[model samples]
Target: MIKDRQLYKLILSILTVIVVAMIGLQLVSSWTQPQAQSQLNLYESDLLLQASTWQETNDAEPGTSPLLENLWGDSDPVQQALKNYQKIKTSATLQSGPTDDPEKRAASEAFVNELDLRLGLLYARSGQVEDAIATWTPLAEAAPSPGNQRAVTAAILQGLWSDPPQLKPQAQQQLESQLKGWFRYQSLSQLYQLQQRQETLTTLRSQEHAAAEKALTRLAAVQVFPAIGGLTGVGILIFWLIQFAVKKRQSLPEAASTAPTIEPIEAQADQTPNTPQELAATVRWPVTTIWQVMVVWFAAFFCVSFVLPVVLYVAGAKPETFGARGQAYLALIQYSLLMGVGFSILYLSLKPFLSQPLKWLPLRWQGSWFSWGLSGYLAALPLVIVISVLNQKLLQNQGGGNPLLEIILNSHDRFSMGLLLFMVAVLAPLFEEILFRGFFLTSLTRYLPMWSAIGLSGLVFAIAHLNLSDILPLTVLGCMLGFVYTRSQNLLASMLLHGLWNSGSFIGLIILGSSVS
Candidate 1:
């Protein structure tokens, strides 16, 4: 008995050490290799611009005036510009045209920057000034040269102060403060030139007759989400209330008299395995069984995300259209709450099922909160992105990208920014990680060799997304998440890291969107 106890302790200690070491490695890796935020924004902006080019070409014929009006009038300038860029880029590349020269490239970039700036101004007109600033800050920083810098800065400041006189004084002070710090290192000649140009624009700002009129026109074209946010909150509250009510009813005397359920108690005595071989055998099947369960769960997840929406449409419930930022915020809260509830239940139930084929999955923890959450976050990031991208591609190919998503991306609306944030950062990351990394990745490690566990998780994660377009991205991310989770042995770590990566990507895209043409 003593030998068995000692053997179990040794195995647990070794696993714990390995998990911690893996987490530390991931932390170091993530810290050292931040995403190329600028490049990512460029890619997204370029993609949007390409899409816009298609509409422009289709709208050029004299007889197609109504179509052009429909396209331009219905779509916000940002969406129209994005689609224009996308179409032009894609069509030109498809036709084997020579790439534009550096000057044209610079011009194109400037156009994109201006479009994003205009969009930011529209957002500000909609009372989302903070978002506008977030969107434009990078444009000001990344202006091509002194001329471009002045143009962008003047445009930004002019937009800020042009709104209302009350808004102008505060905006002018802020703009001046920002410029002072930014130009401190520049040569006197350059500063003088920029200041002269800025003064001219500031004088124009007082008129507010053209730019504000344009901004108002664009703002009128922008659309926001309806009541989904309120509905979601109410739905969640109702779900919890019903759960609590059920438990209270079950505890009543009438309910107790009819049901003869046994209340489980913790075992006071230790129940060590009889031998080393027994201990090993006891863990193996549970790991295998849990992995199979997770596989089924993931497969079902693909259906839920990709296929079920179609079913819902057929059944008459429209896929809920939501703003990107709102969706992301809700997802962050929802996933965190789900994780807390899920792990808590698993931990409480784990002991009663020690002899069943589920003991290998650890709901119980023996580590500090920091280490555990760190492990979970580090382990989950890659897997989440990979799975989501793959799933998105699959849905796209099937013409199953939510009709609302297609509308949001393709239509001109005030909510496009919000939708982009949700898709890339919030919804995709949360669902993918919880299904794959939080469950299957850790469970597989119980029986398989560590490398095998990570590989298996990656393989399953990739396949579950159900599209070739996403396979590469998802596989790479899944492997990274598996490695971190196995190393850290903590779900919390994976969740935090995963959430951070997603949010970071969204923020980076917004920053780049400001500058990319």
Candidate 2:
């Protein structure tokens, strides 16, 4: 017992030393690197000029569209343009105060109107017609100034006429109403008559019919599967909730009648193996010791996940060039080092508390490992699909994209792709499972019920990624990992499931990038 206690202390000391060393290295790197270049100031004229150039060079090839390039490429001129437009519009809105000088107020409003017109045009040219309409609709409707209304109306008309005609009846009616209102307000009867031409309405109706037929055909091809999958998931959840409520109600009566009593020595004997060797082989450390191990485990996790990224950022190590293999190599090295350090900390901290540390760590292979892993993988597929669809819709609504995924897609090369595959599919699965499912879930089970422990561990696992957008889906995945680990009592089962999940995503990314290229 004395030796065991000393060994535990020594293990903790070693883990502490490793963590401190990592922090020191990060600090040294941050201090040694040179400062980054200052950002350039961009104006509306510059952005418009850039947009014009991009549009001129835009290719119809899958990945060659200037808008896509700017969205996913290293130097994002289009995003910068959008940002500048937003900043100018915000400043103008704030500066146009009721008490301000008349000249200043007029200048502010003028700039805001011009900026909105240019922004609407840019969005239309970039093939975002909805966004263009969204930009111009309010300006055309709410602004009382005739000049502002005219400028916005012209831009909206130009956008509607430019491409794939905006032929939806609602869109057309809304625009026509705004146009009629503007014409009546300004007494521009000639302009209104031209817009009301029968030929124009006939052409727009034809375009709308064609577009609707194409959309309906495409929707008919694969719409049924998603509807069925969504309904199935909802049904399963409802059934489970009802069953849980019924079980709880039934259990209350049993709990009220039963009185707890001590078990006989024979019953205790039956729970354990007979021989000392067998007892040593099967015994696990007390739950308290597992919790103690987690303190060190999480410390190492934070050091890598948070501190290391800050160090890399300050060190000017971020790669600026798309498809730069050097960045891939750097990422692999960073991930490897971090995983090694974290695993060492977990293993060392937990070892002394168990008689057979490897078995107690649940590292031993089980006969049913493959079966459990396969089942878990199969179960994860529907959940992954549901979450991915929801996330895509959310991103589309926000007009946002995933920077990390964009980087990965842009950085495609033979060596870099292979390295990414290994890091994501193999290293990530092994180390992440060991930390989250093996250690964290086990530790939580010491104090909480098994299901509650699984939930809390899953939440922590999601939080560890440090990505708010990914938390919900990642938490769902983590819970699945925990369930597999608990059911199989084998870490390898969870690791296998994790590897399969990541491998599928990595392969999909590669395929998508290839198609785009």
Candidate 3:
């Protein structure tokens, strides 16, 4: 028994060392990598700032912007800006367009327009009047809305009428004719209208900044309040533990004196069991045996869930087909198969070890199970919200979110939506609860303390999702599920709670996606 205990300790120590080493390696790797901005898509403001910096530097130094010097040594700022503009334009064309969401397309268009305007200004500053006119003319023609057209026109006129007269007489005449053709009736009135439009845009931008600041302030409050609440709870727990320990020390003498002494024969009979059944009841089974079940479970999980998906991916089963809907459907099918195969393997492997597998798993429905599940669902809702908010904040701090989840969420078609709903709200709850709580947690309880089993299972469940950003929140959710299963001894309870949590997330995502669009 001592040897077995020592072996377990050694294994644990080895695992701890391995985990620490991996974390250290990851930190080192991350430290060595160059840091970049978190936002996947650059905003118009970012480009505008860059453009303004270039303009300021060029204006101060005649022909030498630091940006141009750094990017293209000794090259003209106008040519460097044009090259940058072309690169941005090409990237924007490839990455975004009519097929993208409305918000994304709008942002892309705004960036492109800003880039064009900047390029036009750079050309005008360099005395390339023809190039400046050529740059702005297409933008004016391509502007979808009257407001956008007016903005473009205003930029064009601003460039044309700027100090030192950038335009040659012939090009100025051509541009004026084009402007007349565009406005049709009164050029002066149209120019005034354009100026007013620009003012309105500036006002709108100011309002947007104000709204963004308000939203950020609210988000900060949300993050702060939860942390404060958590700290208060911890403080209360620590206080209670200290008081309990003090009280226990004070009562130790009384407890010793009051404790009854047992007779030798009575003690021997109590300690020694007469039958195998009695001995089995007295002796606690070691939790290490549960590893057998885990080995089988993981083997099945890896083969079906990991290996199969990789094979399919290699075999030209692209996720982005059918407007990225195919990938969601594929994931649904993959998870469904994984659950089916994994459970079947687990059942086969565990069947020989237990006479009543279902009873052992405690899968039977119990009284008040609905109430337990409903309560769990209700409790989990706010936790999910809090954790989601924190997760987003963490992602912002880390400069990215879960890439896999991002891909799934980015799919907007009906098929993808339906498939994602099934994957999250139905299959995920059913299969995940079955594997994590029904099988793994139940197996773990045979050897470990109940809380230890719950925690280990929750940790495994969180890790199974393969998203570091989601680990904390998912672990919390998994522990909640474990608690529900442990209390009710009915898998349905946890499944119900899981489904409710997932459905809420699905609804929230739908709302968020719609709002963004």
Q: Could you say which candidate leads in lDDT?
A: 2
Report the CA-based lDDT of candidate 2 relative to the real structure.
0.54
TM-score-best of 1 and 2: 2
Assess each prediction's global lDDT (C-alpha) against the native.
0.43, 0.54, 0.53
Quality of model 1 by C-alpha lDDT: 0.43
Query: Which stretches in model 3 have alpha-carbon errors above 4 Å?
Result: 1-289, 313-316, 320-322, 364-366, 384-396, 399-404
Candidate 2 residue 229 Cα shift, in angstroms, is: 8.8
The deviation in Å at residue 321 for candidate 1 is: 7.3
- List TM-scores for all candidates, in order: 0.38, 0.49, 0.50
lDDT-wise, the better of 2 and 3 is 2
Cα lDDT tens digits, model 3, 173-274, are 333444321121122323334446667444444444443333333323333443454555456446545876978742111111111131123222223223
lDDT by residue (1-517, candidate 2, tens digit) is: 9999889878767776776566445434333211110001222223223323323233344455543343224554455566656665664465455744687667656657656655765565556767877776666676656545445464445445445533332344334454321121121222233457666545544443443333233222223333454466566546645876978752111111111132223322213222222222232445445645655765666666677668877986655442557767767877887788876777676666443444445655636877777667766667866785585355322211223454465566788888877888899988898888766776555445566767888887775554444556778888888877776767788999899878766664444333211
Model 3: pairs clashing at backbone N, Cα or C within 3 Å:
287-447
Worst 10 residues of 2 by lDDT: 251-260
Q: How many clashes (backbone atoms < 3 Å, residues ≥3 apart in a chain or on different chains) does model 3 have?
A: 1
Clash count per candidate? 40, 0, 1
